[model samples]
Target: MAMPEYTDGVLELYEITNDESEDYPEERLKYTGLRIWYRELAVYDTTRAKLSADSVEVTYKLAIPQYKKINSKCICLIDGEQHEIYNIAHTTTKDGFKESELTLKTPAYEREVIDDTERTE
Candidate 1:
């Protein structure tokens, strides 16, 4: 029983990969340009209420290709909102697809550092 309502939303999948830049070699997170199915697990305000400051929680269902690499650092964007991916467990697999249970939430925003090095002696 496929629900059309749940498939209405689009999920932008992003993956973490190593950037081999000569000067700024680091892990780079970029979108794989893959669109997957996205749906909220719970629509009630209870989930949003329990969220931490500036954090929005949502669960999405998606089937990823086996060739694509996915890690904890992967990012998911839905409805112009970005989310941090947690432990991705496969719910099902068939036809070279991995159905992952991707529950995401907004990561805690880091506050700007206050430079207090100048001491008034």
Candidate 2:
């Protein structure tokens, strides 16, 4: 099964789709309060970053118009490895019901066990 592509870039929590089917449609515009998974940032790189799935805390608008259900744990593929986020949070925009950006603080690479058989010299 092909997985939907989700980037770690700044995301705007829109809304969740009210579908009665089992398969979640990617075309749905509704923003589900779900943690988006993405690649971890390098530990040494000290620079401004956007709100990604790895973000520990997500800052949204001050006035939360609605809330969507999200996965407590999510997997993000970086460099081909899967990384998981523990928790996710959302806030209301200070101005109004606008797109809020969430940021994550995580190590560039999430430690993973490599298979020796896959190694090549």
Candidate 3:
């Protein structure tokens, strides 16, 4: 879908990245919080997810390096909880901005992170 003319850009992303080093398995995962603009999407049933079957669209300025870094395997922290980015829909706006509609593997509700120290990856 095409992005709107303007976005308030209030949402945020955890932007997880793996180190890909076999030697340091413990420290192989990394996380980067990314500011984003998102709107709620319809929730549905999906047997694929171990968590809640919910998703959200993460629209934002299409950026490279970081944009190139994201894929189906990538996961991000939403409110400090882990959520998988199952799909990515990229769009170029009329005024020249990049947008990403990121679908997740879990419910977008109750995303509140209880403890930051509980993160394993």
Candidate 4:
């Protein structure tokens, strides 16, 4: 089957790398400019709140090539916003096209504040 061509929008996939240095222990997500075509499946309000605030659930339909690799550890950058990929299901469309349904959750660290207060003895 041939891969379907999508003209909706481009999405960037990022790989999360854990950096554990003495200075900082953080997860670094890097994007290698791997752009692909993806369409928005649905965006609705969720009953659960994220970070003690309201949130929404988003789903995307990605037309990825059969040889491409996508996993749960990957994050999707859409419209300058990072979304965590929770579930990925590969399926063949009725038109003989390979597609992947990505169920994304809101970013975990949306509005993180850094506290750099120093303690004086």
- Candidate whose lDDT is highest: 4
Once superposed on the true structure, which residue ranges of model 4 sit more than 4 Å away at CA?
A: 1-3, 43-56, 59-63, 66-68, 110-121
Q: Report how far off residue 100 is in candidate 2 (Å).
A: 7.4
lDDT of each residue in 18-111, candidate 4, tens digit only = 6666477676676655777775564344423341264545444355544247787777777778888866778878877767877677767642
Q: What TM value does model 4 have?
A: 0.66
Off by over 4 Å in 1: 1-5, 18-27, 43-69, 92-98, 108-121
TM-score computed on alpha carbons, candidate 3: 0.43
Clashes of each: 0, 15, 2, 0
Between prediction 1 and prediction 3, the one with superior TM-score is 1
> What TM-score, to 2 decimals, does candidate 1 have?
0.51
Which 10 residues in a row give candidate 4 its minimum summed lDDT? 112-121
lDDT of 3 by residue, 1-121 (tens): 5435323323334433334565653222233444454555444434234233333433211222116556754555545555656667776656666666556655343333322443443
- The TM-scores, one per candidate, come to 0.51, 0.27, 0.43, 0.66
Model 1 backbone overlap count: 0
What are the per-residue Cα lDDT tens digits for candidate 1 across 1-121?
3322335566666665665755766554565666666544543566446653445554543434332356666776676666677546665433343455565655443222122233121
Question: How well is each residue in 15-108 modelled by candidate 2, as lDDT tens digits?
Answer: 2233456575322233233333332233223322334433543322121223334332333333433334333445444544432122333434
